[model samples]
Target chain A: MTGTITEAAGAADASAPRVREMSMQQAVNAALRTVLREDPRTLVFGEDVGALGGVFRVTDGLQEEFGAERVFDTPLAESAIIGMAVGLAMNGWRPIPELQFDGFAYPAVDQIVNQLARMNYRSRGAVPMPVTLRLPSFGGIQAPEHHGESLEALFAHVPGLKVCAPCDPQDAYRLLLQSVRCDDPVVYMEPKARYWDRRPVELAHDPGDMPVGRSRVLRRGRHATLVAWGAMVHRCLQAAEYAAEDGVELEVVDLRWLKPIDAEGLAASAARTRRAVVVHEAPLTAGLGAEVSALVTERAFGALAAPVERVAGFDVPYPAGPLEPQYLPTIDRILSAVQRTLEYKRP
Target chain B: MTDTTERTFALPDLGEGLVEATVLEWLAAPGDRIGRNAPLVELETTKSAVEIPSPYAGTVVRLHAEEGEVVQVGSALVTFAVEGPAGEADDGAAGQAGIVGRVPQDGEAPRRRVRLRPPEE
Candidate 1:
């Protein structure tokens, strides 16, 4: 069932009423539709977004209402799409482009780096690329090649672009709008496979309300901290739930923003738990999880109860449909990592 | 030597090397003139809806299949008739362009930038 749309329109506004449960993809679609209605500057585009409503039906019914000119589809050009977004943002239009799948985003690397990432810095703050690239990311969907990738590090490494991932439907609804309204370009990574993951959600239409570059501590536990974002957050939570039966408590943090990370929140959390575990779907070699774990080790070295741990996808190409399960970090892997960290004796 | 050409249209890898695509609709019929890489057919894959470009700068001599049909890798989708020569148009391996890299590989450690820590209690 549909929930009451948010009455408020920006970050300065207060929370409105609550609503019923909705799928994450639907929540995101609602947010996009609401934003387009409220703001004339908002534009949504990507391949198949106009007619096919996207591969996952995320953009369903948008073109019919907004018209193809507003919510339109583009030629099969990822780099051109992103580059065009930079131009549109420069012209004061808010563009939310869909990358279709996380794995398929590689072709736009040049545009993302050369234009999208450094738009502000390149323009010396004279121009702000208010573009939101929604990338439906991660594996476990049993998809074919270029369908199940998690390339957060590729965006996070760039200085100008802000990287964010939402853990649940609620976050997906809110942060998506926030990403669109932000002054800087944001790569909003959604868990592609979890599009149908349902949860109780309250909707809002506001922008400029949610703070960028912040992480939310989902559960409070003293044993250790389990940090994850996007789809991995659910996995981490599941691992914690199963671990709790075995007498282990874990503090879970959903890092909504990957870039300009909430170092303060993380440092404080590490001080309490005195241990850390970072999880992501990207490969471990030079991945975002490593960057986070390194940050914890560097800043909160004295607050350590155990070595910083990371649970991530293996360092090989995300396998085909059948082998994808082995590629992603599972509950067993996370729990074992936590156990290993707990059993560590400081030497 | 006659003034005819055989341009073989190899299905382009729609960015992620999507091995197969479903023929959603055929925009051009047989014997239709298609520019080089002009969209001859529309394809719906698991990734996105894509327009299959005409690999040859010639007339559409034949269409390999019908609408709503599933096409496999290395299967010929269309053939074009060129004007000048009697040689094969060397359309290289179907390549994907302007794509976003989405997945991490196997056998490698997955890297994460955010470490979870306990909140202040």
Candidate 2:
């Protein structure tokens, strides 16, 4: 019976790896453990990281294995946490500080944009700030005030900071490891809504060698290019599936990096499709979607069949739990944007 | 005239208008003597867990809430026995120092008491 069940499951999910299925949160935990084991100079600290193992338990069991010095907790002050990280990175330690939540990171903006980002340049390459700021962001879970937010564009706007948001368990595991090892300070945003989504990931390969600013094409198509990252990537994939029923083939690109965006990969994809649509969970006004759309227009304008489109959240603050659905971009909204781009005609 | 010996240490508003907190653990027992600013109990709120220090330096006569109990703001957490007036000594200490999680600056005014409802007109 066991053999038959295994065979049936294998047939059902051929892409599934032979290894165990892991959630995004579990993948992050595994990645942190791996990095801490490999790098002696690396230290992980943030609020509730020690005995409590973090509020979300992402740092769970890390303190027990790595000891208190390596994995410890700090006072509930975001600015002080980031300032100390800058100091530690300057002194030769690779400090990884967890910001607990997205909205809470506002207090540390001075330290992050001013000190962390400008250190290497201000010192004329004499100093390298290799700090990783882990932020849990985005909405879908009904959390109280300041819990769910997607403020990626804020850090992406900074010149020196490298911003990254991974959508899946595999990317979360790999991209996080890469971010930690990079010489520049990286803002690693984790979509909290997708934390429990499980997938089978190959653990044998090292993701440390993966290029940081490259985009991955999850699906190929000729009609339009759908660019997204973090939770919106999955949403775009679903929209593509929905659009396929009407014979619209949408190429989905997971923009793994936000800052130093994969402009070349995006242009190549847009050039082939001759049309583009950018999607994100942040507000529409000055979100990353605008940046991606502008990049495509500048680089791939000659190949465009229509003006680039964008589907994003409203400009207002992320609404309370009941109204979040309307605030976020749904599959219908993405499909409508894709439909509009497909119907555009030259005057 | 009232004979004032035991004082009730009402749990102060931890700011942000948070209503209640779960008692994670108690650092001092009913019969134990605790110093001012020493952690008396640990409480877990929605944002973070904080060690609440004793406002009065005296012997703890009784603990109002047990571990794992959700205590409301303004509820009596501990009763302490002290010499002289019941509230005079602790009032001065509370004004001078702040709680563990919510520390006040040297020249900053003491936090205003948090009230659940508007005052009567």
Q: Please tell me which predicted candidate would have the highest lDDT against the true structure.
A: 2
Estimate every model's Cα lDDT from 0 to 1.
0.77, 0.80
Model 2 residue B52 lDDT score: 85
* Candidate 1 lDDT over residue span A1-347, tens digit each: 13234442232245434564878778888788877876788899998888878766678788988888899989889988898898898998999998877877889889889998887897899988889999988775565788778888888988888989887888888898778767888999988756767787766534344588888899998888999998888777777776666667789999899998988888788878888899888889999888888888888999887889999988898887657767888777787788777777778
Please write out the lDDT profile of model 2 over residues B1-121, one tens digit for every residue.
5344787787765533244779999999988988888988999876579888888888899999999999986778888886567556546554223642121122332222221121112
Candidate 1 per-residue lDDT over residues B4-119, each given as its tens digit: 76766655545333446799999888878877666778888876787766656778888887888888745788777887755344444223212232222223334333233322
Decoy 1 TM-score against native:
0.72
Question: Weakest 10 consecutive residues, lDDT, candidate 1 chain A?
Answer: A1-10
True contacts kept of each: 0.03, 0.00
lDDT of 2 by residue, A253-278 (tens): 99999988999999999999988999
Interface RMSD, one decimal, each candidate: 9.7, 22.1
Residue A137 Cα positional deviation in candidate 1, in Å, after optimal superposition = 0.7
